[model samples]
Target: MTAPLHPGRFAGKVLVVTGAAQGIGRAVALQAAQEGGAVLLVDRADFLAEVVAEAGASAAGFQADLETYDGAEAAMRFAGERFGGVDILINNVGGAIRMRPFSAFEPEQIDAEIRRSLLPTLYGCHAVLPHLFARGGGTIVNVSSNATRGINRVPYSAAKGGINAITQSLAMELAERNIRVVATAPGGTEAPPRRVPRNAAGETEAEKCWMADVVRQVKQSSFMKRYGTIAEQVAPILFLASDDASYITGSVLPVAGGDLG
Candidate 1:
């Protein structure tokens, strides 16, 4: 569903949102556009066009892989050329690439997990920092996961822990320059089924049990004992990106229904 038109909380702003084809990224893009910002939605999926359309005339879409620095730089350039400069950047392009025990993961799988859950944020910040500095300052909201402390995805967890470190260090380093860096650690969120599954192959019973264990642990960890909604996840993210959170920086707000990681 489209977000309701707002009284311009982000009027005259140019925003870039990674992974904006679906889930929390899509929700943030829609809300940012609804609030009068010109939004640029980036993702590897062709369905990004749909989000652009849903976001109305104020939005554009770019298809790019954010896991690589080159891809991240290209996306940032696309935003710069189309929107002049990015006033806000939402780095929401990471997830657990697979569900399995750490001991069961091959070396390649461990590398993939870091690439999928960490590099996008790291490379995104690197690629966009110059533009933000040129503009005097901007807001960067990285989407991290509460799985930083969960099961069956230790590599993914470590990646998010790295994100927490990134948020804190960069915020301090950029404070004098007016750039604010913050993150949201979302608990398991309730959203539509993935159009493209992270792992599409059939799993063995053991693998299925492992994934179930992860889910069980997630629910058990949440104070609310339930997964959060897309809207619930987006609220804190957009707030952190907006003027209301102008005084806040270097913090990772947990939107995990009481699951603070």
Candidate 2:
């Protein structure tokens, strides 16, 4: 079941949520707006405007490729200008692009995985620092994955591992700065079909089998033996981004049904 929205929980705050065109990012943006936040939804997807409309007057959308530092910086600058300053940043841009055995991955494929699943968060954190500092204090919620310890996507796993390290180290470094850094390691989540499939090319039979294996491993590892709903993932993310979790930082709360990945 989804958690109930706490009206005004985010009153007077400005929030930036990446990958907001769909799925968990979409959920967060709408909920935050409903809770009184002025939200900036960022995505390169064509459907971004739809989410912005759904989020109403309190929300706006920015289209940017977060994989590059320039794109990341541009998004942050736009947010700062539009919202007057940003108080919370949810780095929801990363995802595994392909599912296959490590040996089957070409060198370029590995690079793509790292670029997709790591660089956005890395660039986002760096780009948003000045804005957060300007605000006196803020929160950063990185959406990681429990697949870091599962099968078929070694490069993606390595990327999430990097995020885990970033959360820990950045938290300690910024604690004195009044900025909180944290992450949520989500398990297999049952989201609606993607508007933009991660791998645009149609999957070969071999690739399909490999993906099936990944699904199997994910469910088997989770103590609940099932994927979670998108709401289940978004609730904790908002918690970490809210003042309710003011005392929490440098932590990766696993929303993986007891499979602490």
Candidate 3:
């Protein structure tokens, strides 16, 4: 569904969102456009043009890997050269590329996960802040996870915990610059889990039922006893990215459906 239109909140602003090709990233990017900002959408997804079409021309799509400085550099250049400068930087990239049993995690696996899940939050902030600060102020909203509350996903949880730290630290560092920094942590919701084709090729009904049971267990962790909506969670995110949240910073807003309680 499209966001409610608000022309003045982000009018004439240049915004950028990393990991914007799907899921929460797509929701955030599209909402940013609806609110009157021109958005630079970044991700490794090849079909970003479709994403732009979905979000519209106020949106420009770019494919930039988050693994290396070269990838990050290309993204920074795209924003400066094409959009002039960014006024809102949304750090919406981060995820578990692969899952592993907690007991079997290798140091290399943990390091790689950190680089993927935490580094983009770091690089996007560092890369985009100069443009924002140069304009004398801007907004940053980092997407984190409710996994940080407990019931860890091994390295993914550890990495997200680190992201929360970055969100807090950056908020403090940028406060004097008139920039607002905050984060949104979402709990397990109706959003489908990433599909693993090879593993599910011949799953049995009993096996699937067991998996469903596990998901219910995860959902019950929420105080509201339900999952959140893509649109519902995205509202708080857009708020933190808007002038409405002008006085908010260094805070981690939960879209976890009351899960932390």
lDDT of 2 at 253: 94
What is the total number of backbone clashes in candidate 1?
0
Total clashing pairs for each candidate: 0, 0, 0
Candidate with better TM-score, 1 vs 3: 1
For model 3, state the Cα shift of residue 86 in Å.
0.6
Where in model 2 is the C-alpha error above 4 Å? none
Candidate 2 local lDDT, 73-110, one digit each (tens): 99999999998999999999888888899999999989
Which portions of model 1 show Cα errors greater than 4 Å? 1-6
What are the C-alpha RMSDs, in order, of all predicted structures? 1.6, 0.7, 3.3
Tell me the tens digit of each residue's lDDT in model 1 across 1-261.
333445699998899999999888988999898888999999999788887999999999999889889999999999999989988999999888778888899999899989988999999998999889889999999999888898899999999999999999999999999999999999998889888777667577888899889888999999899888888888888889998899999999988889887
In angstroms, the error of model 2 at 177 is 0.6
Query: For candidate 2, what is the total of clashing residue pairs?
Result: 0
lDDT (Cα, tens digit) per residue for candidate 3, span 1-261: 444656666789998888888778888888888778899999887777788998887889889887676787689779878888888888888766444445655687678777888888888888876688778998888988877644324677887888788889988998999998899998765654533232333545654564465457567887778777778777888888888888899998878877762
Worst 10 residues of 1 by lDDT: 1-10
How much RMSD separates candidate 3 from the native structure?
3.3
* Candidate number with greatest TM-score: 2
